[model samples]
Target: MHLTLALASAALIATINANPSYYVKPIEDENDYARVLELSLLFYEAQRSGKLPQNNRIPWRGDSALDDRGLNGEDLSGGYYDAGDFVKFGFTMASATTLLAWGAISWPEAYIAAGQLDELRKAIKWATDYFIKCHVSEYVFYGQVGEFFLDHTFWGRPEELNTTRPAYKIDPEHPGSDLAGETAAALAATSIVFRNHDPEYSDKCLKHAKELYKFANRYRGLYNEAIPGAALYYESTDYGDELAWAALWLFKATNNTMYFEEAEHHYQHFHLKERPNEFFYNKKVAGVQMLLAQITGQLEYQKAARAFCDFSVRQQKRTPKGLLYIDKFGTLCHAANVAFVCLQAADSHGIGDPQEYRQFAEQQIHYMLGGSGRSYVIGWGRNPPKQPHHVASSCPDRPAPCGWSELDKNAPNPQILYGALVSGPDEADKFHDRREDYVYTEVTVEYNGGFTSALAGLLQLRVKSIT
Candidate 1:
């Protein structure tokens, strides 16, 4: 058995060495966490919707998607665009905001150390403000701003797109529990971030959050069926997990027993199991379990969280290069999200194996930072991607015509998308740097949020070790 194990290990090493990549050195950078955190803010700046302010960090981008007014004349103006497209998906936007806000709540010092707390705060406010606007009435909530087909037709700057973008909403008749729940979670989490800094705003946020949660619970139905437009994208399958996720955040923010009871009910209703290998916009089981374990110090929650992490580390399929594999398309995202869970578990006060979980999380993050022999982040390590599938970044500065030729072949992106993390390498750990390959080279706001959370956790662990 020992000899067989040795042979297998040697073969894996040989396979990893055979893979071709530009990065050929061990990862060693004390400033990586700071660098990534800075870049994440830049990504948010690029994805800004509505009137681009004068103080915007991304100079190349101007006012964009300003024409997005809701069907009921509600102002659906501000929020980050979803993925590489100029669309505002409320579910995804809320999920991203919740994760980003959680990172801020978990490790404010990391942002302070990196000198980006103000930027992070502004970014969080941008989304929460949009959420507040979207929740127009007791039941009515705007969930989407632009049509996928119409939005996908244009490939240039979001500011230049002058099409008639339609808006969609959810209410009692058109229920969207998942969307409402997630929006509540985002708002609840945001309230915590502003609890001390801005008491009035925090109370307002929490007030809206509670109302939205009530709406979600009262009208329990999927958004896709009611709205139909969400079917193509941002479609929600189950609303149970989202209910629990929102409830948990509300409980965290307010310490309300009612919210805790709701959270516990939904968590058990779903019969939380070992986390699946993939973490996507629609899935929140693993995240809920992990948070529950950390916050409540429950034995069941800890056991499930451990089982999920163990599945990711030991049972999940992996690339020869050591990345936990789910799909070749955005493989790094799954790893990044799970890395965050591991990192948080590592610091679970005393519920988890801090050393072991930290090691696992670090390995996954190192792979993203070039331990896989190439950097997946657009502007970080040696020979990072120069042609991410981003419309604004791919266009030349000011004068040149931004067309298919430029996107397909003419030149590398005229602007360096500083900290944008690309989708990443294939299942075999092979990468192609080009604009057309959206799966391997696209950047998203939420994607950056995941990386930011993971990096902040890493920085926190490092600081804890020294202190």
Candidate 2:
């Protein structure tokens, strides 16, 4: 650690140790959740893969992804970019947007209390609108916006990058069930968010969701096969889990028995009864089980949910401080995702005793919020991430030179991403807040969704306590 950052960390640690909640208070936690929603939208604004909308509030970014894939003269514009890169991976965007909408649906009160309900709605609508655009036909969905080789070469704002951003899609013969199913899930979930607010829009979302689900079912293949270029990035080995996930959400949104039957069939066919241990975007079994438990109140679903939670907790690897470190690359992401599931299960009424699971969730979440001796959220709590591995954040305010040398310096990010959660510590609970180390300091919408969802659940618990 550099001497300056090291001293700053030491001072921040002393302050936090003196007061356990100094860096993690209820009011501040609510503020953090709201800020996360804001920053998630800002990340989208900074990396929008198409023409800038007139209503864009994020001033630092503008239209950039023009010449996006001359494939069939399709308009492949207006989706959130993937990570720090300008590519718009529809699969990942759909999944992240679905989870973000899930946070809104499950905890509307938290968003309202935090004064972020409108922003959350806007973010969900932005991604879902892009999904609508991606679905040009009944059986076709464009899956990607930029070529990896071309986009990876540039490390500047999305608006500044100008290159061949190829668009990829899947058709009836060339199937992409996983991507399509996840998009369907995102639309279905967002439909619920707007059902009361905008009935016409809700119907539009559900209509597209149903069509996408049909496409996913009619052509049962992974997306990478159709778009081979995506193999290196958003590849999927199986599509059954996504199918089941979409079906369940569709059933929930429309309250249709046929959708429920389809979900049940897919659930049984995929044997989700045996939940997977990982909590990343690729795997949906654990989250599906939690949702199923809540919807059906079935003992089997509850059993699976508990089994999955227990399996995650029992992983042999852990930081000496017991942070449930899953992998070095996305340590906090995995833990935060698991924490969300745990808290979701704990909130489900008539389920098994949720106290234990709640406690487990709290421990993992607290670790991310400075319980591990430093905070991982950018511009929050104590000793937060000063240097995030984000291109826009690395560059000076705008119209300034942003080079590799700028990222190498031991300085705070140029932008104050209040609620952006950085990739966290290693298995030993050690973290380096450096911009060059993307693994440790990178911020992504998906990562923020996971942590923000968990924090929303936590704040929901606090509201329950006070009332």
Candidate 3:
């Protein structure tokens, strides 16, 4: 690390570590969560894939993928790179946005207090604007840009990328209910965030959201079925959750009776009332029920949310360090996603046991923030993950040729990817901070989505909410 940055970070981290709540029961520590929230938004800026904005904060990132276009010459640029790699997978990107928007809506006061409200909204609009371009028509939407296999084969700065990145889309004959529905949810939920800030943009988001939801409902099929290339990487397990999930968001955004009824219909048809084992891009049943519990105060939905959160608290598998070990890949991501959902349940009115759920959520988030021996989030806490399996951050500054050779460097990433939460430790709390160990060290937008949101929710608990 640079001498100046190291000295600065040391003092800042000390304040966080000094908080008594770091070791004992949860206490109001708004500073730490607020700092993490600020850093989280910066991580999204580093993941941008299109033309560079003048106010771009990531100095290493530049205008790339400007030539990205669909088969019909539809512009397909400006969304976030799906992960450490440069591919832009719409399904997961939209899913991340939905979670981020949900957090912004739920904890506006926290964001405002952190002085990150504007940046957070900008982070969201970056994806929403890209979605507008990708939604070329009522039935057609670009689900992915750049093939996974081809993109993964190269390793260097995205600005210097020279690989062929063909855009993939789904239309009437090739339906992708999961992708369409998730995108619809992202737009609808984001519409709520932008309603007062920019009414015109909010209206545009709702228009596209309604159209995409209609397309998803009319032509139902898995996104991976439409685009086989995406199947290899981000395959959809089922579209039912997304269908119901989008309906719920649309209902929340528009307050339309039809959307609420459709959400209920999809919930029953898809059998989404049962507690989900995990929550992420592919599965959202737990979130669906939790939102229903909050919105309708229905007994069935509340019971389901309570059951799911209770399992996460008492029954879910955990690492020696207390991190929820959901899956081997992206362990921290899954844990944070669950943490965010449980936080939603905690914040929901009259959902008894808010203390247990919020405390559980705090422990999980703290584990990522170095409550354990090591920090899973890059550029935060002592001995944070350095050699994250990422391309751009791994590369040196411009005028330097970065290639596969750079991947073998036995040092920290040249550029610090601040606030990036890496796919974390194993069941025994074993984590190897090696770039080639992509299973554990790779960072992604989806990884930060819920982790960042959970930070915001936790921040609210530490500070006063807006009156």
Q: Each model's RMSD to truth, in Å?
A: 8.7, 7.0, 5.5
lDDT of each: 0.79, 0.76, 0.87
Ranking the candidates on TM-score from highest down gives 3, 1, 2
- Please give the TM-score that candidate 3 achieves against the real structure: 0.93
Clash count (model 3, backbone only)? 0
Q: Report the lDDT tens digits of candidate 1 across residue range 63-141.
A: 8877678776778898988777787888888888888888889888777666667778899999998989888998889
lDDT of 2 at 204: 96
TM-score of candidate 2 relative to the true fold: 0.89
Candidate 3 Cα RMSD (Å): 5.5
Candidate 2 minimal-lDDT segment of 10 residues: 19-28
Model 1 vs. true fold: TM:
0.91
lDDT of 3 at 296: 93
Task: Give the clashing residue pairs of candidate 1, or none.
Answer: none
Clashes of each: 0, 0, 0
Q: What is the lDDT of residue 20 in candidate 1?
A: 16
What global local distance difference test value does model 3 have? 0.87
Q: Which candidate number maximizes lDDT? A: 3
The model with the greatest TM-score is 3
Give the Å error, residue 81, model 2. Answer: 1.1
| Global CA lDDT computed for model 1 | 0.79
Please list the residue runs of candidate 1 whose C-alpha ends up more than 4 Å from where it truly belongs after superposition.
1-31
For each candidate in turn, the TM-score is 0.91, 0.89, 0.93
Residue-level error in angstroms, candidate 1, position 16: 36
